[model samples]
Structure formats: structure tokens, C-alpha cells
Target: MKVDIMKKRRTVLNGKPFSIVDDLTKMDLTERKKWAPQVKQLYDSGTRLRFSGGKWRDSAGKSYIFVFNLTLDKKGGVQKTNFNALDACLSYLDKFSLDDVWRTRNPLSSGFTWTSNIDNIRCRLDFFLISKKLVNKVNDCYFQPPLQSDHHIVILHCDISIEPRGPGYWKFNNSLLLDPAYIDLVNSLISNYSSDPHNSNQNPASFWEGLKFTIRNNTIRFSKLKANDSHIYEKNLIKKIAQLESDSISDENLLRELKDARSNLHLLYKNKLEGIMIRSKARWVEEGEQNSKYFLSLEKRNK
Candidate 1:
């Protein structure tokens, strides 16, 4: 029979929920009577984040996510034989390496779990730990009996967060899309400026270079220019401008990576790009009011 939570009676002591309130309150690890039965509850938290081994809470209240897959046909009997949860957890880590992104503390890092489900088949879980004792339930799944199908039918019910990572970022103005006439005007300006070097102490190509180079230096400049001919949209716009500037950063991939530095607009911020995004004068501090906003999304920083 599956473990049923609905039918159980919970004992709450001193405003905390525990596996066994009486057992947890009086924990004596050396004593067999106290230690043997509730051994799982007696964890010695180490250094900094004591519960760092598993998932932890996110800035938001939502739990971080962990995911992995497993192939368990080699493990013999299904019903009679008992499977180890620790082995399952290890197997999950092997399949999906969550540790790689966890250190960055991006939205992706979290821990995974595997437990037998109420259904006839074994199940896998992608959970985020909220605390040493609390965790967020994200992906709940179960497998079907290995009937005619080559593999078990696994049904996944997931609650994943897709945020600023989703598409549609702010766009630049279309006037920067250079054309033949604009190029001709730039060449015309170059001819005029270069021809009168004796009369004018200004740089020879200053006029043409100013139009071509300034567009990249300032996004606000792109908003003001008037397009005359070629109207480049995405990559084409970047390519055309780069060709004119000689040293232009028109690559979409590179552009996305430098979003935080280029603009305060980022999918998320990193420490290096933090204060650099700020662009100018503050109207002095206000008293008795909080200046920063904190959004709480729950997440686990492990697995």
C-alpha cells in the first residue's frame, strides 16, 4: 500500500511540525531508543549554509527546480523488493548535472528526488528545498506498468517558472537602418570634411565617423536618426552598422551576453554588471521609506 498522508494525525508541538514531536523534542543521538527510529531527523548542519546539501529558498517564495531521468529495468522485482531512495537520488544526479548551474544562483539550479508513487510504477520528482525541513513540490510524476510499450509511460505534472527568460526584449528604433542615401550623405559629409582640412582643424572623417560610430555608443542616438534607404531589422541591422563602423559589435549572441553592461535591461543581473547599469542623477533620498524592492520566489539551490 502507498503512504497515505490524508489519513494520518499530525502532532504539533511548540509551533513546529515534526515527524514525531515528542521524539524530535528530546533527541539523543547516542541513545538507541531515541536515535534508531528517528535517525533521519538528526542531521549535523555544517558551516555557512547548514542545509546547503539540498535545495534552498529563492529570492522569491517559489522553490528552485531539479530534474533527472533514470533507467531501472536492471533492478529486479518490482512489488516484493524494496528500492533504495539514496541510490535513486545519486542516480538522478548522474543523469542531470544540476551542480553546474547551482553555484551561479540563477533560476535553474535546484535538487531532484525519487520516491515510489501511489501509481503502479515508480516515480521521479523535481523538488526545491525551502528550508532544511521545507521543500516546494514542483514536478510530481508516475510511471505506467511496462505493458506493450517499450518503456514505462511516465506522466509529468510540472510547475516550472518561465520568466524574463521568455522572449521579446526592448527594441531599438528603426531609423538606424542605414540606406544608400544615408551612405551617400555620409560619403558626401566625408568628402566635404576631408576636402577642407586646411580651413577646418577637425578630423578628416569626423562627419562620416560621427554618424556611423555614435549610433553604437548611444542607443538614444538610434532613436533620433532618420533612415533613408536600407531598412535592416535584426542581424542585418547589426551587420550593416558594423560594416560601416569597422569595429562594431553586431553579433546577436555577443549582444545578448553583454545586455547588462550595454543596458540596465538584462534577463538577470550579475555582480560585475550591477551598479554600471545606473545612468544618472538621483533626486536625493526620502525619509521613512524603503528604497529597494524584493520579490520572493521559492527555489532550491541544489541537486
Candidate 2:
């Protein structure tokens, strides 16, 4: 048996403060009348119809509100035919002292969180509404690339205080050896150090240690620069791919570019995953239990 759940005409809340309610239009005449008194009671009590069930409060006696993935237009404005519905939503927000995190941060921003090529529609329908008390805690809010969906992912970064820790050891990336320019630069550094009379004055052991330190510093700097470049490149590629996918329906040329971009991204991920697997296997080999049949079997299974 298949259960068909209808998701339309409903609001989904994330925190403890809000309750779900079915759309008023979905109720039959009798059901509407049956719920009329309860709805009126909620209104009279200054509770939003959609968020009528509960209230959330923290240990510090601070109230919080959360509104997630609301249905709205491109400008992040809520639209409804019923003036009462709109008034209830606005009044509830006003009463609770809530604010839109996105709008508060990026008042001039315009973008779409969702798109439908078939209907030729694009809009920013997803948003986060939080209590004004938590507004200062919001570090950042932005859109991210979606996976297997027409809607973009909304990311919220909040600052939370925690115990600080010292920096851990850094491991050199072996992938840098794959670059010919890196290899040449390292070689030149070694040659220059050996030729320098200042470095030649040192003993053999000291010279070797100094050379190793020089190479390590250069390697760390090179890797950091390369990683930053790769990060920027990947972000650009993802944005380009998303735009191409959105526009390719009308242009054949864009489709080819999209395929190429996807292939490049796939290759990038493949390389990164391969590096992670290699590092993980290396760590396992160093720390894994010895001469155990179960461990051997697990290793074979992973292979």
C-alpha cells in the first residue's frame, strides 16, 4: 500500500514554539465551522493561527521563534488572498518581536531560492525568521547549491561560545609533489641554500635540519595558497554550473558547457575523495589492531 501525503498548503516549523495547521481552504464547510471557535480563541489570545500550539523559551528566560522554509514570493514577501491570514501573521510577528534574518542582513539583496523551468518561475521562497534577541548571534546567512532539488539550500551560521583549544599538528599534502612547478621551486630553494656561504658555515646535521625547515615552511605556504585558489575556483564552477543548468533549457550551447562543467566538478570531487581515502587508509594501517580475523575481514570488505 502507498500512502500519499500532501505537503502543499501547510507550514513546517523547526522549533518548539510553533504548531502545524492545515490550510483553511482544504477544510470542508462543516470542518471550518467546527474549528471556528478554536481559531477565534487563538486569535483572541494573540496567538498566530498557524503557530497556535506552544511557546519556546530558553533557560535564560529568553523566548525564541523559528520560521523555516516559508512559502513566499521572490522578494521574500508573504502572499495570501485572505487579509485576516496576513494580519494574523504580521500581528503575531509584531507581538513576539521577531525579525527576518536575511532581510535584516541583506536588505538590498535579490535572488531566488527556488525555480521551476516548466512554469518559468523563479522566486526566493525559503527564509528564516528568528527572535530579535538572537539577531546579534547570527554570524551569516546565505544560499548554497541544492542537490536533487529545484530549491537552493539556505544556510545560517550562528556564533556560539565554546572552550578554545590549541592548534593541532599540520600534515603536508603529498598531492603538492604532483605539481611540476612546486617541485622546481623546491629544488631551486635547496640549491640556493646549499650554495649560500652562510648556510655552508653550518655543520652537516645543522645544515640538513635548516634545509628541512626551509622546505617545510615553503611547502606549507604553497599548500595554503593552492587550497585557497582551489576553493575559489570550485565556488565559481558551482555557481556557473547552477546558472547554466537554469538557462540551458532555452539554449543548446549552454547545455554543452553545463556537461563540461559537471565533468570538471566530478573530477575534482573524485580526486579529493581519493586523497581522503588514502589518508584514512594510512591512518588505519598505523593504528589498526593486529592479526585479528575480524579486522582483516573488515579491511577486505572496505577494499
Candidate 3:
């Protein structure tokens, strides 16, 4: 699912001219009753609402609609005043078949949000109301900790099909010969093939075919072994460095090991990038220019 932030002026919500009265908590019962029709109108027009418990005023002289219990404690409870206001707001939404996404999925549980050390009043300070049509499209809902907010992030996984990717094309890395270990492995494979007695009586075509098959098998086996070792080596080096730093200690030997591992990992990445460029048939990406912005942009376009 794609995620993004939608920022808009409070004067116009869901493309409608609505007053921006943001402080729903300070609103008297009469004011809430006054705005009920406007809220219903917006909800009917495919406007999803997120209650933030934070207030603001907009150009249209309307209060921002942030009506939720912000100061909840621990055990799923709320102040009488806050509970009344929440009930009124939810009553309006429930009339139009708009429901909390999480509560609808699990009716026996209360939603979660920002908490405080106040009177142990557990409540959901953050919430979203979705119409029946959009609710049907939703597949799952969960929360993630926000990077820079006190509130947890809410995520919606909808039943939207992603664009299908094309069939992949594979290419062997001829640069493998540059590595001493790879050269030695290839030579050893050839030596073993020549010494095998099973192919001593084979014709010229059969001998070449058998040799090619043996080389391909050996290449695949070595490639798998190297791939596994490369990943494990990189992971172990990173873990070692992290452990040393966490203990407030420094070791020159560990540092050297980490540096060498990083160099090798960089080489692997370079090989993969070159392979990608070759597969794209991008001749414009000259040597030493593969990391340039133009090369990256063109490579993405080609893919």
C-alpha cells in the first residue's frame, strides 16, 4: 500500500466550503448540534475524518473538528465529560454507517492512541471514520510507531492490485574471472573434467557438451556458496561493530575487519549495478558515471 500525508486548509475539507472550528473539545452541546449537519454532509461526500484532539481555527471561522480523548491513562476508561462528547460525535457518525475501522473489525476492544500519566483513563485520542463503501475496500488495519510524533502511526492495507512486473532477464557476471578465487575454482573444475575417465571415449561434440555441462554445474555451485558467505560475512561484521560500540570499547582489529568487509560488500554492489546497466542496454552510462544522477534516472526510465 502507498502511504503519504495529505495537508490541506481547514477552510475547505473534502472540497467543500466548511467552517474551520477545530476545537471540538471546547464546543458546547449547542455548537456540536449546529455542526452535525455539516459533518454528515462531508461524510456523505467520501471525506474520511481523522480526529486529532488538537484544535485550530481556519479562514472560514470554523473550528477544527478534533474531538477525542487525548488524556487517557491505562485501563480503557475516560472522564465523564470527555466520554459524553465522544458519544455525541460517534452517534452522529454511526447514523450514517460510518464506524471506526479498528473497532468495527474487533467489536469487544477499545482503540489505542497517545497516553498520559493522568487519572489512568484509557481512551483512543486518535481515530478515523470511513464510509461503508470505503470500509469494504479495506483489507487490514494496524499501527506503527511514528518516527517523530508522540502518536502511533495508523496504516491501512487495502485490496488494491499492484502493477505487474515484466519477466526478468538473467546475465552471467563475466567479471567473476577478475577474482583469484574464482579463477582458481574454474581451473580446478577444468582439471577435474580432463582427468575423468568416463569421457575418454566420447566423440568431439559429446566431449565438448559434457565439458560445458560440468562447467555450468560447478559455476552454479560456487555461485551459491559465495552468495551465502558474502551475506553472512557482512552481517557478522556489522554485528561485531555494533557490539563493540555499545560496550563503549574500541578495537583496532575489529575495525580493520569491518573496513575490509565493507570494501568487499561494495564490490558486490558495484557488480550488481553494472549487471543492471548492461541488461538495460544503456550505452550512455559511461565508466565512472554509473553513480551519476543522469545514469540513475535513465536506468529507471529504461527499466
lDDT per residue as tens, model 2, 36-64: 46545543553322322112233333333
The root-mean-square deviation over C-alpha atoms between each candidate and the true structure, in angstroms, is 20.5, 12.8, 12.9
TM-score of each: 0.19, 0.54, 0.39
Superior by lDDT: candidate 1 or candidate 2: 2
- How much is the lDDT of residue 144 in candidate 1? 28
RMSD of 2: 12.8
Model 1 RMSD, rounded to 1 decimal: 20.5
Q: What C-alpha lDDT, on a 0 to 100 scale, does residue 97 get in candidate 1?
A: 31
lDDT of each: 0.31, 0.58, 0.53
- Predicted structure 1: lDDT: 0.31
Residue-by-residue lDDT tens digits, candidate 3, 110-203: 4444433243333344555555555776788754332234464566665654557885643466767787998898888788878888886788
Error of 2 at 151 (Å): 4.1
Please tell me which predicted candidate would have the highest TM-score against the true structure: 2
Error of 1 at 77 (Å): 15
Query: In model 2, which regions exceed 4 Å deviation?
Result: 1-100, 103-110, 116-126, 147-151, 161-167, 239-249, 276-303
